[model samples]
Target: MKVIDTVLNVLWLLLCGIWMALGYFLAGIVCCIFIITIPFGIASFRIAGYVLWPFGRTTVERPDAGAPSCVGNVIWLVFAGWWLVLAHIATAIALAVTIIGIPFAWANLKLIPISLMPLGREVVSTDEKFGGR
Candidate 1:
């Protein structure tokens, strides 16, 4: 399973991951340029990492997150989130057109939510034990 995941991830990177990640990276840079939106910038960078290597990992909502995350998500949506979502959707469609790219397309679709609301999400490797460090 690990080997398969690695192979899929590699293919994903070649097909669409790099382009999606680049979109996130560019958004992060722009968000960081403004002092008030720095938090959103940080979130963009976090999602960038996830999009870069989505297989073998998952993103979960943070149990302790509260109003701040909600508010931040709104701001993110207004400023950059929509753009990322569009990019992910577009890439997903393009990848889905070919039989070989179906898995990568699904991965790209899975990323849309995080791209839209990056705040208060945590990425965890699927193979890691629940209580392990």
Candidate 2:
């Protein structure tokens, strides 16, 4: 399974991961420009890494996340999340056009929820037991 994930990740990176990660990177840079949004920028950067090599990992809700995260997520949804969602959806559609891209398309679709509400989440290896550190 690990070997398969590695192969798929390589293909994904070659085909679309770089581009998607770049989108997140740019978003991170923009968010970082404002001191108040540094946290969002950090989250964007983290998600960028996930986007870059997504195969063997998954995102899970952080147990300690609280009302602040919810508020931040709302702000994120208003300012940046909507566009990210659109980008993912667009990318998914484009990827879905090719037979080889179907899995990648599904991956992109899977990313939408996290992109929409990233503040309360953490990316973890699938090998982790329920996202424990």
Each prediction's TM-score against the native?
0.93, 0.95
Which predicted model would earn the best TM-score?
A: 2
**CA lDDT scores, all candidates in order:** 0.85, 0.94
Worst 10 residues of 1 by lDDT: 124-133
Task: Show where candidate 1 strays beyond 4 Å.
Answer: 129-133
Which residue pairs overlap in candidate 2's backbone? none
Candidate 1 structure quality by residue, lDDT tens digits, 20-61: 888988998998998998888788888888888888888888
| Tens digit of per-residue lDDT, candidate 2, span 16-82 | 8999899899999999999999999999999999999999899989999999999999999999899
Q: Which regions in candidate 2 have their CA more than 4 angstroms from the true location?
A: 130-133
